[model samples]
Target: MEGFTLILLYLALPSLLFSAVKQILTWRKSLGSKPQFPGPRQFPLLGRVHDLPRYSLWLKFKEWADIYGPIYYTRVIDQTFIIVSDEKIAEELLVKRGHIYSGRPQIRSLIRHKEGPTYSALMDRHDIWKAQRKWAHAAVAEAYKHHFYGHVEREMRRYLGLLLLDPSRFLDYTREYCGRVMSRLAWDDATQGRANGDSADTTLHCMSVSGPITNTITPLWHLPAFANPWYRYEVRREREQRDWWLSNFRLAKDRMRRGELPGDTWAYRYFEQVKKEGNGDLNQTEEQEVFASCMIGFLNLVGVVTISGPLKFFLMAMGLHPEWQKKAQAEIDKVCGGRMPTIQDYAALPTVRACMKETVRWRSGVPLGVPHQAERDDEYRGVKIKKGTVVLACEWALNRVPSRYPDGDHFRPERWLEPGWPTYQEPLTRYPNFREGQAMHSFGWGRRTCLGQNLVDDETFVFAAAVLWAFDLAPKVCPRTGEPIPIDTQATNSHVILEPSPYKLDIKVRNAERGGQVLEGYREVMGELRL
Candidate 1:
């Protein structure tokens, strides 16, 4: 009887294990028998979900891209995602075949308005999106043609004023300066009436924090409330903030209707147009649709919202590497002599431009960037790609690839001066200037690339050059240990944006007399602009 039992147990165990293996193979076969991308093999129901990295997903994507080529699919649970890391593949899918690849996937939040449609980042690709993009294009183009220079001048003056006033408040000064600059561009003034009765600076304060919360914490909002309690609070806070922003939107719309075009706010202009149309050119359906989709605050806020991460990253990079700052400052000083750097100064200040370019390359503010969704079925390198696939481009990985930048990890601006760079040999682009030959996808690739890249380009140069000229930065030393406090160039806070972990530094005035130069210089310029 014991012998019989042992033989029976062995037979049953083998059969059970075989069944499990067969079940997994059957599941894979059921998932569209087309050649599966060479990903970590899946379990019966789990797929390759467990293989995904929890954070720093871009790193994992780069690893996978190397093993599986540019357009490969990985499944999480049952959902499959495609990663497009190669420039040529991204261009083909995100640009050439964009009409099919342009549609963003339908996330739960996009369709949450049970009764009526909702306004969200994940709206469908339709006429509304086209119109919204058109409005944004027109608004930015207008600013470029007539108002961008004025905003740039005002920003330069503000930066100088803040630096001159108290360099101790450098962080605050930088934040406020950037906020006010975008505020003027979007709202025509730095009043920040969005804060209700709060201080004029409140809007800027909100602008500063919003970037981190949205860019880093937003993904966490997807976790189940029970599994991740932090998301529960984030959802509550996000709702409250959304309500607050909506109220401000309504107020701004009202003021624009009253013909109170204060400074150079793009919202005021867009709002004025919506009111003038008065449901005539567009029907009630169109009016509400347009309003819901392309409200001025909704559109213009994206500009201010995206700026903080890139700007902060730029500041921290300059602060950490004083040598790079010194070189850039020297170049600017040589070119401008006593004058401030301007758009024309771009050609003469290659080192300064290289610093900006290297900053973007070294640590892209938005490392993974906003994900792009494929609209239809496609093939990449003869492999089948299904419709409605979500694709991510690893700009961080692209920038740091050993092949592209030989010693990929170091922060060396002189690398750009290497024999082959600035020649457009690589299919990928760099930042500040984006032509076919001089492509920089830091803003992004294809149609939906960042609209505010131009604005950011102007602001980044001015701020970096001006701050370095005014201050000499070094790492703060530990009093007891006699060692420098370690700084994190990569200690990123991931929200909808990425920011370096806040760290300490010792900054001395470059010239004792010029301590107030940033502010004093601004006052003089502001005096002229006020008239």
Candidate 2:
């Protein structure tokens, strides 16, 4: 009996010691210096865990930003959070000190990539992450050099066809429009030029699963297996994700084996560009390499899947603010005449570009920008940011920073035109440009920022110019009252992406000449594709 008791004590000693050491450290931290940033008052041990809500977490983050300054923080147990609602602070930490502030946190509960390569942006700050980002940029540049405008025009033509046939389905068609455009650009319709539903389904699942945890201010994502309720959910999701990747990868690769895919497709670049960068040591297995490549391609789709976010916001903006719509149309008319506008006219269509930028700012797609981790202990404004601390840019709050956009919630495209505003620019042709390193906060910040931003910019700018040029967008009329029903900003999805609930838009072709031009473009492209 004594021997048994001794064995049990010996077995429990390490855990007991760990608990004691942890308690001692917490006590010391409480008694000693802490991150000097102001935030919601926290409770002992649990920190600000009580402040997090289950839904619309970004709204809460924004509220905190208003209440507790732009740069604030919260702690959840041992984990630390630093929320940056100010653009200047984001630039300071995420840009100037990017080398120290670019690490990804340990999200073991959400991503199960222990045996494989994870998504490029989600990867820890490592050689592979750097290599993948480099390849992504190179691949996008290569695609643009070869067939950039081709894909946009093809998808744009089909979008016009669908919209003309059924204007009531504008929002649905918008989602499909962006999805299919990116789908083709990623794999060149290897699934026979059709939109890949698998990518959408898997992406939706992955985002939905991670959204709850990732979108929160006090991320309890570091909890161990026994204490985590999301573990089983993550496991199931992880398996589905892996299965989806393998199957899609096999299909794309099988087509490539048969020379069905064109040389400009991402599949070709995955092998020629992404894989060619390394000595084949980045992945663990053939499966891992397949996942890594598929994730690269999958990421291409995910960004566009949410492209609907900005578009939905644009539609709402158009409905709520018709004066801006008129301005955009006038610009398109001046630049494009009776024909639909293309990327070539971008220099002359500053109003259209400004309208597009406004949608993202008015209601950002990623409100709580994906949290960036610190690779080392860093000090900012005399505050100590411990190593491994998770930092959030919080775009929703950043755009609303009192100093940046005084009337943050309102939609005003003219802000980009006024020299008094921060977004203001000179030379209408050049200032409304989607140049990175500016304070847009749309593409994110630092070394970990998106490398495929130009591709998105091209697709969105052309879509905006063409849509406003081709049709007049307004709000639906109330049948009984004869007043235009106000468009709602409430989002449809549960995830962080603020996609507007399907709303009615009053869309009508402005004139016959533009209508004919749209049909001509659609017929010419669809007939050539044989779809």
- Candidate number with greatest lDDT: 2
Residue 487 shift from truth in candidate 1, angstroms: 0.9
- lDDT per model vs. reference: 0.58, 0.70
How well is each residue in 279-385 modelled by candidate 2, as lDDT tens digits? 34223367555655556555655656557778777877887788999988887887778777777887888788888887888877777887788988888888878
The best candidate in terms of TM-score: 2
Candidate 1 lDDT by residue in tens digits, 95-169: 787776665553332223112223323455666556666777777767766537566656666666655566556
- lDDT score for residue 461 of model 2: 88
Q: What is the C-alpha RMSD of each candidate to the true structure, in Å?
A: 8.9, 6.4
What TM-score number comes out for model 2?
A: 0.85
Q: Where does candidate 2 have its weakest 10-residue lDDT segment?
A: 214-223
